[model samples]
Target: MAAAPDSPLYLGLDFSTQQLKAAAIDGNLRVVHQDSVQFDCELPEFRTQGGVHIQEDKLTVTSPVLMWVKALDLLLDKMKRAGFDFSRVRALSGSGQQHGAVFWRRGASQTLNQLHPDQSLHQLLQGSFSVADSPVWMDSSSTQQCHDLQAAVGGALKLAEITGSRAYERFTGNQIAKLCQSRTEVYRDTERISLISSFAASLFLGGYAAIDFSDGSGMNLLDIRTRSWSKVCLEATAPHLDCLLGSPLPSSSVQGPVSSYFVRRHGFSESCAVLSFTGDNPASLAGMRLQQGDIAVSLGTSDTVFLWIQQPRPALEGHIFCNPVDRQAYMALLCFKNGSLTRERIRNECAGGSWETFSAALRDTPLGNNGNVGFYFDTVEITPSAVGVYRFDSEDSEVSSLSPQVEVRALVEGQFLSRRLHAERLGYSIIPGTRVLATGGASSNKEILQVLSDVFNAPVYTIDLSNSTCLGSAYRALHGLAAESGASFFDVVKNAPEPQLVATPHPAAQQVYDHMLERYARLEDSVLRKSCT
Candidate 1:
């Protein structure tokens, strides 16, 4: 099982919220096989609704650590069923949901290195984690932790300047501090801590995986400019946290060989390399092949808007993470918690759980929903950090209710308009010259895309594949392979495919959205103020 003689294939895995997905592609970028293992459907034993457990509070979301290990085992089996030859894969890389923490038991590295192929991974690594449940981005139970960390480091703005964003409740730093405070013994026994991406890579590399800079940025613990963990922030989180969280590496760093267990069980070549895993958003930027003027609008479980940038100009409004593709650059991002699930809620209520009906409702309404806008947060939103549903009418005044059609249109418009406003603040503009690259589950909806284009008043484009994060990881693998061959990353992935223009703005879209965005900003401020009062 040392080495296999064959054409090189690259494998990319995405350990996203709802599932574990893998994509295999050849040197020419032809997809050999794409598959997934859904946590809710395939692994019903875990009983995850959206690949997470709801302990006590609805907002307290976490996932079982052993469930992820078993998911990997099942995923590899799925690849075998799909006729994927693992030995032919030259390099592997991965993407994972951001801001989630994974704790490792003192001897976890040994547990990983000595994985028994004969036994299931979950059975062997049963006690590998100090904490059984890992906190994910969806969990907002760390508000007190967030305030404490920010107060410890000068203030919220100062922390934002040092790291990427202000201490948000879902950030890994806050989550870690909460864990350390709540469970002191578990913290003491923990040896290594990882971002979700690093945790997945550690399994493949048979050792502690260094957190990638791009993913590390999401933790609110990495200095965005230095690309290193901040000692000051570490002190704010927990005791001896510096050693617990290993060094951060660039996304392009070659982690090591695929674990011997993989070679023995799955027939992967011993020489196969593993690249540092990155956060899903950064990986999507790689998959979309975004240019200077193009913006990425990913609409999955969490909706986000990001654009590539050159400098690390940290802002309090959004995030500035080191670009996964370029070690010398940065990317700006604005994430919203109310995404596909909230959209589905509205669709189910207003459109009778019919997409066609939802589309019809979305399209028939005039642009700006005839001056009706609303903020719908089924969960706590990241930016305003507020929850609840608020409706406004034509005169920009609060309303008790609206028709199903109006409500549907308001929800879609409100979501994109919020993105548009924040994106512009981050120096991304949507004009005739620029374009929005749409990706994720909701990207295929023409109605939604049209709303996006109109709200931003720019053309919206999508590629053949909707799940760009998984493919992005594959592209990163190929890029790493090319770099090892003395080739440029652009040269390696340039010929893959181009984004197809899907929607153009309505003639009056720019004017309508301009007014709506301004109105939304004011209403958003008022809502936050009222809630605090």
Candidate 2:
């Protein structure tokens, strides 16, 4: 049976580093309208002197809170242009870039409200922060802090055993420690430090500070089993956690109603409820209709491989990230910093011409590139390691020494092989029966998709949705609303649109991939051993 046409529209806002993207979805899980607005981050002044990185002393960079507010306003305008009825929007939630901190002052409401021509609450909160841009997840300057916290909690493996994750430079707890060490004055003035998702939700609902489990898990401060802030982790890192942190909430809970001020300013009706916000990746998993044995691969500037697991698994060799989206689902994630960009570089510099030309080139080249050649694509490694290294190698040194074309193919094949190995290590059986959903820029490349399919010997699927991240956020918003009215979360997802295409692996190519994968594993081990020593 079809869902009723009168079902309420759910609004999802994806808060990324570069832009804010908004989407509206109906009860049938169809996207009705979508739009995005770009925002700029103030660059910090830095210099390279005497082979060491130096930053201007007392330097503080911050994002204009007006940017988010303006983004919201522009989204509303775009929605109106798309013929969407703002009043029909039933529930709203957000998915933000995980681990970015936003500080809000407790007693400055009167001061905040009077400061603006624009009624954006995000802008009003700007005055409350000493630093504009908090150390985002991409910032890896907190390596020392990560090492310190890991030692304090125990060893890296022991830390992962307890918290279900290992210490990383980007995790919130480490960033907080870094700030305290470097800028103690600013850390002292901090009031309520919240994740970007919770901050946005708080802004919309007037004033509240609570994060969903998915977002909290990314902080490295939450105990995976307890689903709450870990006192041991916090005390070991930042002892004075008083107002700097907030309570953790489930993703489906309604944090609060849209504030009257926000309603008056944005012309939104008072009937809308704000659902708890979550991490964008978790939201994407929900949006993809992910299940056990199902993997979702996102190939943007970076590649993230996500699988839903029933048990609380420890972070794999400090390479995997496990975070709970809800009570029933935990996401095991592997992210690669070098994904589509590496492929694009290969296409432009190596293959020459458009992506179609690149695809054709791969097809023209025989399986395994006709010999023992492979490509290593790495701008950085998000999972497994913070640094990235790329190299092309061949069993036949003559083949490795000769042709750049062979080297390019090798690199591409190596990337696919690396993903396969990583998946296998995580206990995912990458055999013929596994369901692999590929979404991102690389998914559009027939050659890459076919190569991936051939390598995995599994069916590769892609959907028509161009921006699956935005779609995922919209799906979460819808689910959040439905959960409020006694709807089963899994049932709502089971009714989502079927995948667009299913590309099966070629039997002939699988044997070649099997051999290449063995070589790739050996190469990866050597690289890791060399890097560590």
Candidate 3:
């Protein structure tokens, strides 16, 4: 629906792997309009599968840079056709998939700044990129660079301490190193490097937008503690790197006013402010209205657990990024590859492909599943790095079969147990008033949420919207304006609708999960040892 014409609106855009999405909200924090353009569906001319091209080696993956540019054009036109009131939009912010890098060719800044209102962004900036395709988070082709970086910085642990993460293969610094080594001419000709988040913001700002610290933390080059680029790490990545990467900005920094192109073509007000954009995960945190002591569990195709942190413990596993809402705080994230699909497989086998039956199994089973636990991984898992299905009984004895009801409960309990165990390993502990906010496909199941509440020993809530990333960007848009007047993010969004309270912890939750958690950790370790052998 069109927003009330006079209501001051905030706009948030998400440039994700497969789609470019937009959400606009009024000052009261109500989402008024939404739109998206899917790359593979809308732009079939790119001939992309899942919006990316997987190279022959299969380790390297990328998306056409121009495809993203064209998506923005299409998205704006869509909003215009729908009678969106761009003039009412007072501020804007956005998010992009983390760890992707975009290289601007020398003199491209001039082309960006002088964009003519008559031409589309894609048509005007056709030759603006030094690298036609950007290396995205899915690309894992920089293993050699990862090794060299770890070696140069002492070791993986030390590197993690310095840069909030070890030298990950898909990290921008390692990706940049790979480009410098393999495609020297391209790196040499590159005038500036923008993380995907900053690249999207620049499109609206009509100039280069500074990389926000939240997204910059994913590059394995920024010192999370200092909130600045690490000179040592920069030297290891490439020559003259500081200039190529402009100074990182706070995620809530007001970048500037809307570009002339947007003002003239889209009817956006020239006075509309553009705020720094951040990574999708960080934006979701904002959208979820996460506060200190709150944990957000996104139960998508791959389940992710993230929380706000006052004291970050950088680890070899998981990641630490600057908090988008609170500059002094941090965020830790953990991903489980075995999520909804694995659950679906079990549901089909045990419940005749019925979610109702699957939920009934959960409601009927006792907490902790009577000492039964199962580890289900149809593919190689990211955490604990194990594969194949393994079941154990009360005695910790490996078993080949389980009763259908027991199997269903085991899968649900084990997944939540692992999330709690790993999140704690990253130095997250359940404290007083801690709330677990759950979002994703599986979160709709009340029975599943009850189990999540029992496992975490906290009240569980569900968001009103599914697209937290885009919604969060809209929240961030308001924050950029309010923060300048010394308002906290919580203060800015306090009047928004509260997440629905879905489940509360059972009185015996702590007592039940404590013993099971220890046992589950031991079984996971045992599986890891067997995998290594």
Model 1, C-alpha of 291: deviation from truth (Å): 3.0
Cα error, candidate 1, residue 347 (Å) = 9.2
Name the 10 consecutive residues with the lowest summed lDDT in model 1: 1-10
Q: What is the TM-score of each candidate against the true structure?
A: 0.83, 0.82, 0.96
lDDT of 3: 0.93
CA RMSD of all predictions: 4.4, 5.2, 1.9
Candidate 3 lDDT score at position 344: 97
Residues 1-533 of candidate 1 have per-residue lDDT tens digits of 22223678999999999999998888778777899989989889988889999878777899987778889999999888877889898899999998899999999888888988888788889988998889998899999999999999999889988987889888999999999999899998999999899999999998899999999999989998888999999998998888998789888989899989889989999999999999988888888877666788888999978887664456678887888887777788888989999999999999999999999998788987888888898887876588888888888788988999999999999999889777766656554468888888999899999999998888999865466888889999989867867776678898887888999999999889898888899998887776666
For each candidate in the order shown, give its overall lDDT on alpha carbons: 0.87, 0.68, 0.93
lDDT of 2 by residue, 143-162 (tens): 78888878887778767766
Kindly list the per-residue Cα lDDT of model 3 for residues 39-102, writing each as its tens digit. Answer: 9999999989999999999999999999999999999999999999899999999999999999
Clashes (candidate 3): 0
Which regions of candidate 2 fall more than 4 Å away from where they truly are? Answer: 1-7, 41-62, 73-84, 108-126, 267-269, 311-326, 341-399, 402-409, 431-433, 484-486, 508-519, 530-533
Q: Which candidate comes out best when scored by TM-score?
A: 3
After superposition of all CA atoms, the RMSD between model 1 and the true structure is 4.4
